[model samples]
Target: MDDSKEAESQLNEKLYETRMKFANLWESCNPVRFKQKYGESLKITRDRCIEIYEEEKQMCDKVEITKKNIAEQNALIKKMQEDLQIANQKFESNNKQKQEMLKKIKQLKEELAKKQELISTQKQENKAKLKELNTSAEMFKKRMGLEIRRVHGEQLQFIFKCINSKNPEQLFTFLLRFNEEGNYEVMSCDPPLECMPLLQEKLKETNNLSAFLANVRKAFAALV
Candidate 1:
């Protein structure tokens, strides 16, 4: 019975040792140990926050730079638009001037064409009058020895008719009055001696029949 009591005592001692080991293991899971392990996690979280802040600041700086660049580009575009507007206005002004000059040139061309037509008509009339004069001269030559005064009178009448075709009453009246007086009237006639100096000066400038016809037309229009 004493040996049995000795064995129970040994078992009780082993159970006491096992309980002490379990108690030590449970104490390792306390708040002091958990705080030591989680302190490093708090430091890691602080570093991550600083890194994110730095990244966000860089992004904001890039956005500001981009905004400034966009503003500069917009200013440049506005300046170019203004320059284009000014250039367009200048071009329009120049084109308007060119159009006005062209209009004036067209008017001058029309005037020149009218003057040429008047010159052509006068040429035809003068040519017909010259042919009539030549025919009358031939007729006068054929009757030179017979009725000289009558043929001379007819020639003078032919000359009167030729001048009357152009100057109508002006030249015909002067020629008829000169025939009656047998001498030219200086101050009293329609085309008096006063016109001779002006005609002499005009002939010095242009000795052509075209200029003479222009002068004759002007005189006739003035008489009208």
Candidate 2:
């Protein structure tokens, strides 16, 4: 391709040189004066005139051909330049669009990262709250059990005091009523106790409340 361009340049230079030579030949020729001086020798002058005319005509034809070629080449060069300019503009536009897309993608990734961090933080907070609630519930259960045991101890002391008192039968009757109140009904203790069973037999046989009370106290001691 470089060789072809070099050849074309050399051809253009030669054509220009030839055209300039023809122009100089026309400028130096004094046609009217030559005719006036050579009219007496008309035959010689007429032949010379015809030869010069043919030369001028051939030069003009060559110049016209060169001009036509130059015009066509100029038109082609203008079109090529325009095409190159359009291509460059398109390339710049595509590059600008690519840069914008990259920026948007980077922004989206940053937002996603922030959202993921927030979700992880929320999960950790929820776990901590659940642990705290479980700890509080355990403490409440222990406190409730302790309170029930303490109240049961007080009731047991009172029953022990009335175990062999005067009018023991009347005391037993009162104790039976007290047991029915359900205050000492501790289902979660190490061992369970019920006062109603102890008095049931005695009350049926001889209405002997003292014996029932004594028997219940003994059973109570063994259970504890």
Candidate 3:
């Protein structure tokens, strides 16, 4: 606007100068004075026009440079905006992933707790079943009536070393039945009976007579 105003003012000034020269020429019939005065006026107006032209040219150059700078800045701003949008999208995606992972962790924790509860319930059920199994085993053994017999006298004087077995269900049913018939001494292997439970537990670890008898002997030695 300023450049346009300046150009307009220069053009108006030129038009005014031309009108004044024509008026002066019309008033003065003397061509000599007209030439001299008009020549100076023309020089001054030409110099003014040249000055205005230079100013206008400089302003045009400034406007072009400013336009170019504004264009570059706008392009840079657009690129920055695009980058920011992309970054925001990435951040949102990552945040969503983190939330999903947390949800998964929560689900896993709940499942683990449920599994632990199930295991505890199963253990309780197993205990009850084991108790029933033991009771049934005792009843079965009584019905079967398997008893140890015939194999010991002066020919095999044995010193029985065994756990201070109290569970009638757990006791060697064969030995008990024969003890009644044979009248064998049934003493606890231990002197204080402190290690008898451990002895029984050890014996229960195995199935064979060799291992069972070996643990009994170890209990006897421990008592001594």
- How much is 201 displaced in model 1, in angstroms? 9.8
Q: Where is the poorest 10-residue window by lDDT in model 3?
A: 173-182
lDDT at position 165, candidate 1: 42
Q: What order do you get sorting by TM-score, best first? A: 3, 1, 2
- Model 1 local distance difference test score: 0.56
For model 3, residues 39-117, the per-residue Cα lDDT tens digits are 9999999999999999999999999999999999999999999999999999999999999999999999999999888
Per-residue error (Å), model 3, residue 1: 74
Q: How far is candidate 1 from the true structure (C-alpha RMSD, Å)?
A: 13.9
Residue-by-residue lDDT tens digits, candidate 1, 1-224: 99999999999999999988888776667688768767878879889999999999999999999999999999999999999999999999999999999999999999999978877776665556455445544653343211111233322221222233454433422221122212211123244434545654574456443343345335534554
Query: Which residue ranges in model 1 land beyond 4 Å of their true spot?
Result: 1-38, 125-224
Q: lDDT values of the candidates?
A: 0.56, 0.54, 0.57
TM-score of 3: 0.44
lDDT for model 3 = 0.57
RMSD of each: 13.9, 27.5, 18.8
Model 2, 88-187: lDDT tens per residue?
A: 9999999999999999999999999987887667556544533433453344334321111123432322223223444333222122222322112222
Error of 2 at 215 (Å): 47
Off by over 4 Å in 2: 1-41, 126-224
List the pairs of residues colliding in candidate 1: none
